[model samples]
Target: MTTTSPQIVASADGTPIAYESMGDGPPVILIGGAFNDRTTVAALAATLAPHVTAVVYDRRGRGDSGDNADTFAVEREIEDLAALIAAAGGRASLFGHSSGGILALEATAQGLPVERLAVYETPFVVDGLRPLPAEGTAEQIRAFVAKERRDEAVRLFLTEQVAVPAGMVDGMQASPAWPFLVGLAHTLPYDVAVCGADLALPADRLAKIGVPTLTMAGGASPAWFPAAAQAVAGAIPGASYLTVAGQDHGVLHNPDALREPLLTFLR
Candidate 1:
């Protein structure tokens, strides 16, 4: 079987953003954490595609999208999302995970025409959310990527930063895809950037957002991530917060546990 290529759209800054479509229903856009491309999110898309029209895209600099050599800012990514939503018929329900959640919140903050928002583990550094692993975390990740220890980088990211259980990390490290994840690991800093100042918005700033928002965190996820989710939930008005039992940051890949709550919110 052949996969259709993602459609390219020009963002506000004129950078190209790539996106793909599947299924038929109210349009839903799937935004991934840093370093994740549409292919990595195929499983989640497959589940949602059968229900709602699912649009998955490569955030700039990865997959089929254009890249800026100087490293684009988080605001630029928000614009990229806006362009994609516009292409999806001028409005879309956004479902973002990790750093993508950060983008979703920022987009909502900027008053984009998003209909609804569902976010998972956005890593907002509020309420004692654990700080990034020291100052050299980004540098260490770069070194791993440089040595082509891509799988190693992914492992470190999942285990150390993502707070994945040690047992799960050990098992995943043995998988063949670990190498691919590591190769893309260098993009970790981009995810951090996407989060911007991490709930830096003032009270009035957050109160201005009126989109129906759903903030989700995995019950088994680290305390910090859930704290971050709560922070986001508190900031937005009328946003409902829920915890998905037995789910984690990677719940997007584990749709059996995630789809119901997600569809319920987005649909």
Candidate 2:
């Protein structure tokens, strides 16, 4: 496995974001979804290293990154990506999964200098497939995190925000990954902030992103994912949509499934 020690970059807000780089080609930054840090995509980075300089980083407040602010905003996260791009020589392709996909799209909309962008199953609810969060859902999640009710925060996020079934949540809670989920539960509100309260596709904003873009979903992902991916792709002018066969939302867990398509698109 290719491995490298993490390096730090200061975001515009002065928060330190930790990232590690591997390989020797055009840079590609990997932005992980909720409950994920730099390590979550380390294997994918390693797999892509031979073709591109893959940089995987912890978003602020997770893993080795430092978060000093009392509040979370999507702008800060965007700035974090901006900093990573700067560290990657000022122009790089971005690959974001889930809420990370939302962040990448928002950053591009805000005029970040991205050469190319790829996103996997960003969870937008364009056709009312899932109801938008209640008006105060972000606040409620923040309160739960403030009270240190990590488990409750995790439960609320999985059940309400992500719409995972109750039985599946119960099963997940009993699994070994439950502890990791709880550990990162405080960032649930950040994820909510990235997706926004509306949970609808920001067609106008997404339409403004003027980069080569690829939006993708897993063939076996939940019913809502393909629609969400398609909606996002359709909203963005010139964006292409793809479905990775025999995969689901956890497709990142199997890096090989993503290797060829990403290489082809990114190259």
Query: Highest TM-score among the candidates is held by which one?
Result: 2
lDDT of 2 by residue, 19-124 (tens): 9998999999999999999889989998899999999999999987998766888989999999999999999999999999999999999999999999999999
TM-score of each: 0.83, 0.97
Model 2 segments beyond 4 Å from truth? 1-4
- Residue 227's C-alpha lDDT in candidate 2? 96
**Ten residues in a row with the worst lDDT in model 2?**
1-10
The true-versus-predicted C-alpha distance at residue 190 of model 2, in Å, is 1.0
lDDT for 42 (candidate 1)? 70
User: Which structure among the candidates has the greatest lDDT?
Assistant: 2
Q: Each candidate's root-mean-square deviation in Å? A: 3.2, 1.3
